[model samples]
Target: MPQGPLFLARAVYRRRRLRDAARLLPVFGLLLLLLPAFGEQSGNLAHTAIYLFAVWALLILAACLLAPALSRSEAEGDPETDQGPQDMGDS
Candidate 1:
């Protein structure tokens, strides 16, 4: 028996990881924002607010960055498949 390469194309692998990151970003942000609530200093509204805002900003930035990469990846993957609604030729 012979062994074969176990890795995907670099572009495909990166696209998949990026997509995973994009999907998990909200959950990550949620966990971070909730962390303050579980801490001993939960009464400090100012700190919590600042943490929430920072997380929000990071999430927004991540989304902005991922959007273009994802769109570009999809564009690179297949153009023919994404074109919507072929003609039925009823004419």
Candidate 2:
């Protein structure tokens, strides 16, 4: 029997996943921010502030870690490109 089709190379696969995560980061952050609203309304301003700060810090760290890999992938000339309109009237 023939083997299954080959999977994507590890680097490409990892970069694609990273791109996905980068795209989803904002939505993830929003959900995390909303998490406290779903919990008990303890009315403790300090604890809520701490949670918000922690979430903000985590999002920043995640972006920092992902930025390098994402930039490297772009520098490598990823196959997907935005093919804009070909006709621009002025030179």
**Which candidate comes out best when scored by lDDT?**
2
In order of listing, the candidates' clash counts read 0, 0
Estimate every model's Cα lDDT from 0 to 1: 0.81, 0.85
User: Which residue runs of candidate 1 sit more than 4 Å off their true CA positions?
Assistant: 1-5, 41-43, 78-91
Q: Give residue 5's lDDT in candidate 1 (0 to 100).
A: 58
User: TM-score for each prediction?
Assistant: 0.73, 0.75
TM-score: model 1 vs. ground truth: 0.73
lDDT tens string, model 1, 2-83?
4535876677678788889989998998898888878986377887788789988988998999999989988787333356
